[model samples]
Target chain A: MNCRQARDLMSAYLDAALSPSLRQDFEEHLQECPACTAELGSLAEVVSLVRSLPEKPVPDGFHQLVMTAVAAAHPAPRAAKVPLWARFDFSRFGRVAWAAAALVIFFGLGLAAGRYLFPASAGSTAYVPPSVTAKPASYDATVATGGNTVTDTVAGIGRQVAYSAKMDLQVQDVRAAAAAVSSLAEQNGGYVEESKITTGWFGRVSAHVKLRVPQAKFQATVDQVGAQGKVISKEITAEDITASYVDVTSKLIALQTQEQQLLDLLRQTTSVDDIVKIQKELEDVRAQIEAIKAAIQNYDSLVAYSAVEVNLSRPLFPWLSVVWPGLGGP
Target chain B: MGPQSPENREALLVQRCQSGDLEAFGELIAPYEKKVYNLAYRMSRDAEEAKDLAQEAFVKAYLALPGFRGEASFATWLFRIVANVCTDALRKRRQQEVVSLGRQVETSDGEVMLELPDAGAGPSDVLEDLERQHAVERAVRSLPAEFRLVVVLRDIHGYSYEEIASIAGVNIGTVKSRLNRARQRLRELLQDGELFEPHNVYKTRAPSKGGAGR
Candidate 1:
């Protein structure tokens, strides 16, 4: 080490922080260079003198002063025996009877008030409970363009429903009917989820096609598929999933908030153990966030695609096939 | 619990403090009051402010007790809070006190007089040791808070570089560089204030703004 290098390493040298080779070089330089050696000596003296400085006694009543501030801030500690009292005090038959009666009376009064205040909440049933006032915020608040599902209708909120339809129809030719249904679904921005066709010995055919269309075109697609053959039976159902969707979405937002809070807590600690503990909690929060995200994505997918099942069959009798058009056949 | 170990006792005290027991909180902070006060004094440079900052540190510690899982010893955790509460309190004020750094002292006379005490000159001719110590304390307090922290922790408190790094939330390399720069600045201050026996025999020019020292 040269004089400049020695000066840089001198502090670490006195602290015994230098590597063996560097220490050797440092000593070699110091032996030849008096100026650097003297400078190092001065630095050492400063360190030692400061270390020798007497510790100032805390001012009188310092502890009392701090404790008073602390007490003012943290006022009360419930006796640790409270839990024990809770466990044992209810064991007496008379006390338990009184407690049960009081609970019933309190609940009855609360119900009466609740009924008076939110009369419509009970009878005008919605998918989400009226009591759950915390609105389910959008998963991604930036893009909320889909006019109606849970993702689009949050906070200002409306029900999120998934619609599906099943139809059994009679057609002159089941194979041709299935292809027409597939084309119709595709034209409506959807796909044929599943399609099956079978031929009987006498050329009678039956086909089943499951079509998935975007929710916006759900009713229109259903009407078109019904027209593919004479509709023998048609069933359409809407499943309200607002409660489950809202529940999952709320959990997601909460977990994200906790993740941020954990990150802030991690910054306040320099202890390796504290960092590790907080990181573990952060990891768990991250995992839960991802899981909730996936669940919301699944909800979005179900709401986006409305399922339509079309079953088409050629009549067993050739004469019945003749009147297939506009005929509700067996 | 017949004569519990210090760690066990501290753990109990912390547990009770977390449980909202004010008395336990008081006991927990009593032993650290002197050390905490001195550090607070170092950062604030005013006795009244130091007292307030020390109390604030304890109050903050009390509020944060639930999160203290004994990862670091109670003393380490508490002193970290002392450093934080005091430094944060001073940060805004420090930003406004833009005194010239060691790098900025205009030594126009070209007399590079560093107050590094010569080996031959003992403490006899200069001020009394106590007076010199007070000067050192003033010089230390004058150092900008960041540099002052490493100096106080390393030189005054005898904390290891690693401990300083942990408390200051900086790496060890930062701790080393900060100590070197702070001590260099302090040497200049002591010499400029005539608090040390200047190595007069072979004095060079004043340290060029920033270039002469590390």
Candidate 2:
């Protein structure tokens, strides 16, 4: 075995990637040639040093940048799930491009915001615009989960009752379910008052959606949403404000009657003192009537729509969102 | 319980990504993101270009995912894309510049014969392993692209010869020959540095016809 042959076998020999007989011949050549053996050592040293080179981390937020570039290039995976972005076919909108437009709008907000912003386009159409919704509003317990209230079964059969519910749900994917819940709200002639996915301490992520579906479909919406994930717990409460409503109405009538009487008394009074006293009493009575009217109106809307606060959470795994790659849905 | 093993999860992610689940693609390649970026860095010395090339490789993988018929492991397939992307990019960059394949340095004036590091510094501080590794990196980076590919893939990245062949789209013999030659070139470059004066230097002078001054 010559020095030339020994040099050829050096790397494979270092890797132990050589045939046994061939390795023996190379080893024999190395034993005879100090120059070739030293050559082999230096080659191994170079290989080792290259192997030990420090790794460079991709720049911070690099993952997000890559995702943004990808989203910009392709239609977001969820764009198909959102019918409006499809119908608008923002494809014609050119640069508005794909579902990734949402990412650009809410960059760093994560997929939860993506799901939220998508269905919100639908919510605006179906949701009760605050302008058109009755004024002097206080009570709209969009929380009622369609469960027949105790008022429905009791002696107050035609009762004006406000139903509100709270539900805890566990889902595999919070953002997807939140989107589905928002869509369901729109389908049921309701609006998502609040849909947010937040990352909490220890990198835990959970979503909460507030839906205001019509009382008629309140139960149906709850059932549909519960079907998306395991229902951790549910609580429904009904406030039969029928008595308060009726009492307020009767007081309103009495106050109006007092105001009319004061008006007539003012017409009869000849002295300025008598007229001034009656005018002040009439104003006070009119204010009472207006207050009662506003209370009754609030009761009417609250009774018509139930409020359901759907608290959707995912099972906490130490390795979930922070570690799992694709869970950051499209 | 960890219901799905890593392999099973990756297979499912690849399928989902193929069907246009961007999230699945992200998950599928999460482990390889840094690896691919480093692979790009190995191909091109420019950090920014490496980042762009790495990102481009992923986007290309995503677009072509539906056709990824599981012939190679997703990693092998993905890495091959990175190599092709980086090599093509490096080739373009190389062409636009005055191609220098010898001990040469760029200056405002033009190409200058490479300056050897101060041999007095020596390799006495092996604990300065980062410095030592970086020195080796300079040697590796100076190698010809063809040689650099197999060397980086095999030595630095620790890919088996068969995998290197598959990734480089070459047969095993080509991989071995290139890797061996690449290493020889690397040793010559290293020996030309800190420790000694051209201990194993081969007379490598790029033909003067291409770059007149060099």
Candidate 3:
């Protein structure tokens, strides 16, 4: 091999990447040419020095810093299941755009807050100011309210929203908090859907209760339960199911109409085969109508009764409590 | 009971992280933080920049963890993210003027010399080794970003050609060529320092009587 060829293969030779035959030829050339041998040795030494370079020590509290940043970037949700809507792609907009949009939403909601605050007046028709109604024709006002349902002219009855809340409470007495929550739910014509209480070693107590309360009394019940203890955290979510609700309700209506038409045809039909065919289609439509009705019923229940999850905890040793000293007294 | 294997532990942690457990993600990254920091330090040659790059890579990895399918080991996947992050940082840094290490230093007599770090009070052999190591480091740092990456992955980290190709998003042939060119450049740079000039045994010898002999 010429010096040029030997030089090209030197790195591969060092890496043991060359084929046996090529390696033999390269080794022979290296023995014959001291220049290539010395160059290879120098390369080897350089590689060795680089590999031996001491690793730079990581700065102290790196793990803590990383965890802090991670927590800030993604706060751990109390509920294990993250809502689908919460994961929406808000990253497509720049920060400035998001801020501007948020400002608009805040002012718009402030104007509409009075209407939403009084549940008794929810059925009353409120006048939408001309300025608010004068949006451009191209603008999709239905989408502005979120959900896919176009509620422009439809009655408010079609607008079904499910409300849920989660609250963490540091209570002086877990049992007392649990009883208060259950009593609040009962007072609102509701009940506890699920409850878990654990008393660990040293008499430390914690309770988790999932309460279902009347939608009209959701806020009142939450406030009363929250007043039972010091709330450490709270989250409230409203999910509009108007699109799915409207879709299923309309489908059920259409299927019912079809079923009636089939029944009329069944009465007039004389041939056995025609009767059988109509009856088969009638059965299918009836099944679909039943399924849609079940879905609407589910939505109705979810809308009628909101879910509230409350977590209450107390320290194991009363004297060990640093933050809640007054509550620490046995 | 026996301890859980790393693979099982990693899988469990990944599952928990997917479920929005940040603590589990922290545990998952504990073993790789140092490796990642070292890689970042080598790439940027700035400690502060390395920390930023490492932190950014971890944050990105966490956000993208939901989409991770575990097809490759987490380390390989994380290395790919680190490489991309470092590349972007270098590109941004390139927009500003960057002083190359070991460039010419002028003395009072206007004589040019290679810029080097101050040699601390050490024995001669130790000082010599330190100087040579610094020269080699500067040479590696002076290489083009692409060549420098491949060389670091291959020679320093001791990754296989295929693994380098995967992390670098290049084919094996590209990796091999880049590594070869990088080593050749390093040799040239070191020769200017006379670190390897004395070892070039054939430089004083005459040409062979038979040229290109088989």
Candidate 4:
């Protein structure tokens, strides 16, 4: 081989990468060429020197550190099951926004307090004056002198006892049951004092009834009304109005007496100024007597009857929507 | 084991180390670290860089042990890694063109050249001359990047052509060719007039580039 060709093949030969025949040819060339042989020797020495260098030791904690990193990358399996709210860091901007919303709600409620919750004081209170000014107070006499009054009229009614109850029912037909309850009140010698009914699709049906049953048949009336449906909950309350009835009755009598006196004064007065004053006084006393009579009637109605509130609902059976996979073909 | 039975002990250590025993791994490295470090030092020409490369190789080998597959001997694999790391360091240094971390001193007569600061110095003093050291360092630094890699891997690091090929990911033929070209360049560096005057005289006497008298 020429020098250039030999030089090119020299590296492969030194590496023992040549075939047997090729290696033989290289050996023959080397034997005939001292310069090439010398060059090969120098290259061999270089390879030897490089191969003789020392090996270094690995640094400490390498395995532990790598394992620690791996463990962090793949955490314990239980971490996936934690709820998002608890897992999320509340220290972030989301937490700040949440606090801001809460602050706004509290601040709004604090501002609304003055309008809705202010208690009146004599000077601090702002009362709206009427369009027509109030007339000044006046006096009158000689209308009734000493006779039957409003208080004597209210005291003539007998004493009464009150009863109330709250009942929760589950009925298939709320309207039918409510009608049946009203019919039962009439049959038991009672009248409907107050009655109301409200209906809607969202399972919230309720009826309120204040029925005055004859005092002797109160228990029987309650029992017959309760046979309507399954009762989920119940509450009953009873009170006697004997003392309040008597006191209101006597006060009503006193106001009627004053009213009769003012009416007699009006009849006796001849001058226009005296007559106008007497008529105003008479009207005021009569209005007070009317108020007392209305109060006594309200108390008598409450004491003689029982108010019942029935909360009703239709049964709802919950079901999950089932989507059958590929069952129906069109 | 007794000193006379060192070969048997070494074989036993190799066996145990291959079986994944950490104590055996430590024993295997203890006797070889210094040799590996020196090889790395010559190739990288920096004590610190060599040490780091050597350590990196050991760590790499340890991490790769589980997948070693035992295709070649463990020592051979380790040497391949060390050569690779040193080559990588050299390549990085070359890209940045760093000079004089540490290099040898050679004389014009093809001998290592060192100069003594004082005329009348001790025997060790002559071996530690700064001017001669600088000259040798410049000669090595002046080599082309490709030639330098082959020379450092083969000559300074003492890697076999096959090991160099494995580490360098080249065929053995390429390694040898590169080494030859590197040697030619190194010889030229040693012979250059600027390097040493006596080296010029030896250069004329030395055989030319071609085969002898062919």
Over the stretch B1-214, how does candidate 2's per-residue lDDT look in tens digits? 2649887788889888877776677788889998998998998876767878888998888888889988999899998988889778876776687644444654333523343353223234563445556667666666666778898898778999999998999998888778887787677666766443422221232244346765
Q: Which candidate is the best by lDDT?
A: 3
Tell me the deviation in Å of residue A281 in model 1.
47
Which one is best on DockQ? Answer: 1
Model 4 C-alpha lDDT per residue in residues B192-214, reported as the tens digit of each score:
42333433433554465334765
* Model 2 whole-model lDDT (C-alpha atoms): 0.70
All candidates: interface RMSD: 1.5, 1.4, 1.4, 6.8
**Runs in model 1 lying further than 4 Å from the true structure:** A75-330, B1-3, B97-127, B198-214
Ranked by TM-score, top first: 3, 2, 1, 4
TM-score for chain A in each prediction: 0.49, 0.47, 0.49, 0.45
A26-87: candidate 3 lDDT, tens digit per residue: 99998899999988998887777678887778865477557655755774455657689787
Greater-TM-score candidate between 1 and 3: 3
What CAPRI class is candidate 2? acceptable
lDDT of each: 0.72, 0.70, 0.73, 0.57
| All candidates in order of lDDT, best leading | 3, 1, 2, 4
Error of 3 at A81 (Å): 11
Question: Fraction of reference contacts reproduced per prediction?
Answer: 0.69, 0.58, 0.63, 0.21
The best-first sequence of candidates by DockQ reads 1, 3, 2, 4
**Candidate 4 chain B weakest ten by summed lDDT:** B113-122
